[model samples]
Target chain A: MIDHIDSKIIALLGKDARMPNNKIAKAINVSEGTVRNRIAKLLKKNIINISLIRNVNQMDNPGIAFVGLDVEASLKDKIAMQLSKMPEVRFVSSLMGRHDLMAFVLADNATELSHILYQKIASLEGVQFTESSIGLKYFKYDYKWGRLLSEAK
Target chain B: MKNNLDNLDIQILDLLEEDGRASAKSIALKLGITEVTASKRISKIIKGDHCKVVAIADFEKCGFEFLLPMGIRVHGKQLEQVAEKISSLDAVYSVSAVSGIQDLEILCATKTLDETVELLDVTLPAIKGIKSITPAISSKVYKFQTDWAPLGND
Candidate 1:
């Protein structure tokens, strides 16, 4: 179980995973060892993972788009897994709505994106309908889970 | 030309990708370069805003199963303002201006369906100019990766 301190620590680490325990402790008013122990426990429990992740928007002109698919519900999970295996597809989900599966893909250019969408994803079995939206710009792209805990309180 | 990462910088990035907290000494030892050189390269990469180290929260572990994949249509020219408004909400993970039948696409996550409804039905409606919202609650998220690498250039 995570407490308020844990959530705050997670929030700080969410901003910069490389933050030292001492810095986190100073900011949150806790012992460095306490901060370190909480993080270790969080990691052990699979609650959080500190990773070196690239901010894709910062990358030059790499094609970023969202592809929504209406798949045969029976094969929804299978199709989602298939799309997830593709190199271009970064995120895939089985969803409940007009579209059954949604994927976020990245490519070098429009041509590559077209190839993946038409020749690759569209050709897959169980994909009943497909619609895509090229991301024009990111208004907000972040993953700040701990903030939710704070806001809810 | 203006801002580019050479092979050496890319290699250092690769090392950091595996472990962002790897010290300059450790990176230098692996790459067979001086610690100062590794540190300098790392600094350059950071200054260029090429990448970052971040904590990835597992919603399933955080006690949530999935996020809501939503498409919102906003009225007139209020799209950008509403997007910015939604951006400030912690319930949302991402908000993007997308090209298609829908004007905006948002990813929202919460601990329960009630919270999701509160955010979508109550809070979001309070944002002026939101025309309509179509949401597909995610039952399973197979893959979600933030770590990225630029395509190779010669």
Candidate 2:
């Protein structure tokens, strides 16, 4: 659980992910060392991860879409391995309740999307069915889940 | 360019947008600015623009089962109003007014396929001046974050 100080650190960091620890410490009235220790712990425990946020849409082939699959109980793993191998499929998830699996794919255009689906996904063995949706714009992409816990801080 | 952003400013913006938790020292080193200067500039930038850095989560993790990009072509002054209404819907994430046959593009996330269709059938068509809507469902997401890369000209 995040303590109040930890929460402050997170709050400040959320506002400026690139803020220096010393600046963060100064803002929260904590020592720089304390801020560093907390950050290290957060990272070690998988509370925070640093990664590149690339705009896939602006890339060489930028068409992105999400496909939800209803997999046959017998061939879940096989279908997953095959989809993962496809260069166009960037993300795949095994879900619960409604859809069995969800995936995120990128292609050049409508023609490319059709090829990935009809040629590749449709040909894979034991794949029961698939449904898809594409994203148009982005409004809020909150990386800090901890902020949701702080009563809108 | 004559915009408010200098080269270093753009670099800082790029780094923060990609990973909001980047340290000032690291950002400064990347932009060749002093850490103190970077820290001061970040504070100024946020204050000036009222922008906050955040993580872009995985849509699936947030219980959003469907991601649909819908293109809607509309007529007249009602375009902006109709787009605003659709964008405000709980399931609707983002809306854009584009060129050509489609004047508006909406990104939506929902729990079930039925829910998404219901919005299309019930809420969307009711909006004024709406000519048509075409849906492009994302089968997979390769990358969607808006963090533009820093300069590395060859």
Candidate 3:
């Protein structure tokens, strides 16, 4: 379990992935080296990933979509591997609901979305059916692992 | 190259990355710094435009059932026009004009499959200077990390 100080560090990092260790230490009233050590440990454990997230809409030809896919049980791994090969597919997962798989893909426009679905997705052997839903707006996106991380100062 | 940021800079970035609305005072309190210093640093970074802090939604809980990623190839210099039209669509979540032959990247989440197909078939093709499209049906999202590393994560 993350200790009190560690939790504070996590909360701060979640808010700003770019926070320096000195500030983290100062914020938590720990030594700068102590903060550094803790962060190293966290990274080694794969508890945190610090990276950039660009807003796709701000770009030139942005396209975003959500898809639910049903695949044959026998071809689950094969289909997933193939889907993962595509650059357009960023994230993929198996769900516990009506659809067996859920995914996020990036594209330039509607025409690109169609070609991928009709040609790429449909052409796959195990893909029995595919359904897509386009995102209109993002009301909230809390990647802070809010469930696991506490908000206490 | 952008010089590596210092401690104060990282602290400010961390606070905003989690919640863009966090005040400099709050960040200062958390970081044991004067509010004035925090505010100044934040102002400087925003002016630089390294990144932006904005509000994002959880579409799944918001009742968006269909979400798919699309790749669009453009004809001529029609990137700007096609992007505007696609963004105006009710289903777009995020759009990316990538560096490549394909040109644009789009993310969409909608209420139904029919809407997804209609937008792809009817709305997108109508945009002139369009060439080809590729759709990657996302089956799962294992992880998403928006915040880039400070000098310390490494």
> Largest DockQ belongs to which candidate?
1
Order the candidate numbers by DockQ, best to worst: 1, 2, 3
Q: Can you list each candidate's DockQ?
A: 0.46, 0.12, 0.08
Report the alpha-carbon TM-score of model 2 versus the true structure: 0.52
Q: TM-score winner between 1 and 3, please give it.
A: 1
lDDT by residue for model 2 over B92-137, one digit each (tens)? 8656555444666566777788887888788888877888877656
Which candidate order results from sorting by lDDT in descending order? 1, 2, 3
Cα displacement (angstroms), candidate 3, residue B20, comes to 18
lDDT of each: 0.79, 0.61, 0.61
Decoy 1 TM-score against native: 0.89
Error of 3 at A11 (Å): 1.6
Candidate 2, A1-153: lDDT as tens digits: 556786677666544555778998999898999999987875565444443333333345445556667888888766876776776776554554336665656676767887897778867777778765554543333333311111111
Where model 2 places Cα greater than 4 Å from the true spot, the runs are A85-87, A143-153, B1-154
Q: TM-scores for chain B, in order?
A: 0.88, 0.71, 0.68
Q: For residues A24-91, what per-residue lDDT tens digits would candidate 3 score against the true structure?
A: 78888999999889877665554554433444534455455566679998887777767766767755
- Judging by TM-score against the true structure, name the best candidate: 1
DockQ of 3: 0.08
lDDT of 3: 0.61
Q: Which residue runs does candidate 1 get wrong by more than 4 Å?
A: A144-153, B1-3, B149-154
